[model samples]
Every structure is written in C-alpha cells, then in structure tokens.
Target: MSLRTVARDDLKNAARSYVVLGVVGVFAALVALVFVSERNIYPDPYRTLFDVSFMTFLVFPLFVAPLSYLAVAGDRESGVVKYVLGLPNSRLSYVLGKFASRASVTLGAVVVALLVGFVVALATFENAPNLGRFATFAGVSALYGVSLTGLFVGVSAATRRRSRAMLGVFGAYFLLVPFWFGFLPIVNIGTVLDAVATTFGTTVTESTRSFVNALSPATAYLYATEPVYSGVTDQYPQLAGTFGGESSRIEAQLWFNVLTMAAWGALGLLAGYASFRRSELG
Candidate 1:
C-alpha cells in the first residue's frame, strides 16, 4: 500500500465514525454560534473574526485530540498493525499516512466552520468583513490545526497502547492549552514562574511572560497571526502593555512565534517517527 492509499483508507474510516461526525458537528455549531451571538456586540467584522479565532485557540486542541490520539496506537493494540505492516507499506508511510489523514479531517472541519461563520458575519454585521484579513485568519487557523494534529498523531505513533496515547495527548492539551496560561486553578506555568521568580529574588518581566506564554501552541498561534488582526493588542490590554508599544524584539516578533508553532509540529513528527520505526510489531 502507498502513503496516499493508506491516507485515503484512514480518511474513509474516520468519515464513517459517529464520533467524528459529532465532533465536526459540535465544532461547526460552536463557530457559527460565536458569529451569530456576537454580531451585535462586536460590530466590526474583523473583531468578530478575532473572537472566533480566540475561541478556536482555546478549544481546537480538544477537538483534534480524539481524532488523532488513536491513529496508530489503536491499531497496534488491536493487533491490526501486524497485518498492516505485512502489506507493502513501510512504517514511515503508515505514520505519514495517519498524520495526513487526520490533518485533512481537522483542516476540513476548520475551513468549513470558518466559511460558515464568515457568511454569518457578512449577513448580520454592520461593517463589511475584510476578505484579505478573513482569509489570513483562516490560513493561520488551519496551520494551527495542522500543527496540533501532527503533535497528537505523533503521540499515537510513539505509543503502543490506546491508553498511553490518550493519556499523552490529553496530558499535553492540559499543559499547553488551558493550564499553561492559568486558566485552571490546579496549577499553571504562570504560578510556577511567579514562585520561581520570588524565590530567586527576581520579577517576571513582560518579555519573560510573553516568551513563556508563546511556548504554548495556542499562544504561538495567536501571536503568529496577530498581524492579521490589527487591533488584537487592544483586545488584550496586558499583551499591549507587554509589547511595550513595540513588537520588534526577537521573542515578540511574528516570525519567532510562527517558528515556535512550526517547530512543535516538525519535531513531534520526527520524534514519533523515530520511535515508531524502531519498535517491534509483535
């Protein structure tokens, strides 16, 4: 089997799953809801799109997790991997195929939902939506989804059991998504950094905080695409202050954050493929 064949088969299988259908439905509904409900509140079409992007930033990881976490580990656990490997396909093709298939499913959902939201914004909003900015937001959002799908698919490829893959994927989601920015009270990077700063008799500067926050894929996505949304900084007063009226610094630069997000996806694929290539099928 070729890589395309494997990817095609996987996509077909995923399309048949009720879980996948439910996920796509819920994701589209949420995006549409944001566009409809916030039309009156955020009169400007760009701001409305920004709000939709922010919502996706928070929830896209969860949406992509289940779709990808079972890519390979589930087959391995069920002994189907043996049969798969027995085909003319190499492990590399198998892993890449899984990644491609899952990424396609994810990107497809995002594009459709965003398109629907764009139509809603056009029809209901007073101000006209900027096509260039809207397209840029969609492009950045799609890149973010692919990055996440790669990461989760990597976890699936690296692990041999379904439980391990699920744990690793969601554990990553909690750490990098919600908990990273102190959205949860349990424990967060911000709290830890504060304690470390106090113990070391130092303060966390704006640049330091921004740098740390950018380490999360979600934050990286936002910063990477902030240029498209001109008033993004105004929406986040703290971030505006953090940039200190200038965003030319290395950490604050859009390229750096874009690299950060891209690195996560690239490194994840490399690491997982290395592990998957060496593991015994039996």
Candidate 2:
C-alpha cells in the first residue's frame, strides 16, 4: 500500500482505540468545566472560553504524553511492528505514517473539546461567543498538542522497552520540562554576579531568565496566545491580563513560539526515524 494509504489506515485504527476515546472524553470534560465555571466570572463567553482553554493548554504536554507514549512503543514490544514492516513499507514510511496518524488524532480531540467548550458557553452566557476568536484558539491549541505528541512519540520510538518508553516520556514531561523552568531561579548565577557588580558600584547586567522560560513549550504556547485573550475579568485577578500584548523578558515572540513548537515536533520525528532505521527488532 502507498504511504498515504498506510497513514489513513493507521488513523482509522487509532480512532477505534479505547485509549484514544478516553483521552478525548477527558479533554472534553475539562474544557466543559472551564466553560461552565468561567461563564459566571467573565462578561463575555469568548473571553471566558479563551482564558480557560489557553491556560489549560499552557501545560499541554501533561495531556498529550499518555496518549503518545505508547504510539510506537507498544507495537514494538509486542513484535507487531516487525510484521507491519514486512508489508512493503520502509521504516521511514512507517514512522511518518504513525506520526501523521497520531497528530491527526491529537488535533481531532482538541477540536472536539473546543466544541464542547463552545457549546457550554452558548448555553450558559447571554453574550454571543466570538466564532472567529474561538476558531483561532482551537487551531493553535491543536497545533500545541500535536507538537507535544510528536515529542513523546519520538521518545517512545527510541526506546526498546515499553515501560521505559512510557516512564521516559512521563519523566520528560513532569520532570525535565518543569526542571527547565524551575532551575532558572536556582542557578541564576548571572543575576548573582550582577548583584555583586552593583555592590562594587559597577555596571549591573540583566539575566536571561525570560529566554529560559521561553525555552519550555508550555511557556511558549502561553506567550503566543496572550494577544487574543482580552477582557479577563476580576474573578481571577491573578490570571487577568495573562494574554495581553505586553512582552516581558520571559515571553517569547509570537513567531518564535510557532517556530519553536514546529521545530520541536520536527526534531523529535527525525530523531525517532533515525533510531528506528538503525535498530534491530530482534
């Protein structure tokens, strides 16, 4: 079969899987809650929906890791991938096909959840939802989820053991990425040096903590969506203005967030393909 056909078949198979269905349900429920609760706080449905959805996706990896960690690792462990490879498919085609299928599934789930949010907003609030803004949010949120899925799938493909692959992806999401954010404060040697310089009546330098925050995909997603979520009400004052256009040191440029997420997905797929190409199944 052609690679496109292979990809289509993979998509169908994933759509039927219980795990995929379960993830979709969880996302829909979360989005629904966000919509139902925020209606009372924000004056407009669009703003309420946008705020909750965008904030929920800030840690998008947490939602994506479980579904993607077993994308290839489970098949590889069960020896099913070997037979599939024997069916006139190159390793690269297989890898690409799986990536396409998983990304599609991730995107579909996000759209459904967004739709649930939209419905909830319509039912609860008197103000009309902004279809245009909601559409934009859905597209960006799906892109973020797919990017995270690719990263986890790559980690899964690289590992021989299914348990290791699963644990590794979870670790990368819960530990490594968070560490990237947390370690910045702990190791702000530059800031410390600047303080020392100030004590000496010398020029003080600024630290690159913002650049470090932008390095995390979660932070990048949050920064990119900040432009669209206006009218954050007083209910959650702390979360208000989160989506404002004001660029701080930690906020990545809008273009940078898009590029960083795309780069992350591409790099992860490439790494997985390379590893799959070289490794022996037996």
Give a tens-digit lDDT track for model 1, residues 260-281.
Answer: 7788887887789899999987
Using all chains and alpha carbons, the TM-scores for the candidates as numbered come to 0.91, 0.84
lDDT of each: 0.85, 0.73
- Candidate 2 local Cα displacement, residue 211, angstroms: 0.9
In terms of lDDT, the best-performing candidate is 1
Show where candidate 2 strays beyond 4 Å. Answer: 183-207, 230-251
- Kindly give the stretch of ten consecutive residues in candidate 1 with the minimal lDDT sum: 236-245
Candidate 2, residues 128-213, lDDT tens digits: the string is: 78787788778778778887888888888888888998888887775436565454665443455557778999864334545655
> Can you list the residue pairs that collide in candidate 1?
none
Runs off by more than 4 Å, candidate 1: 195-204, 231-244
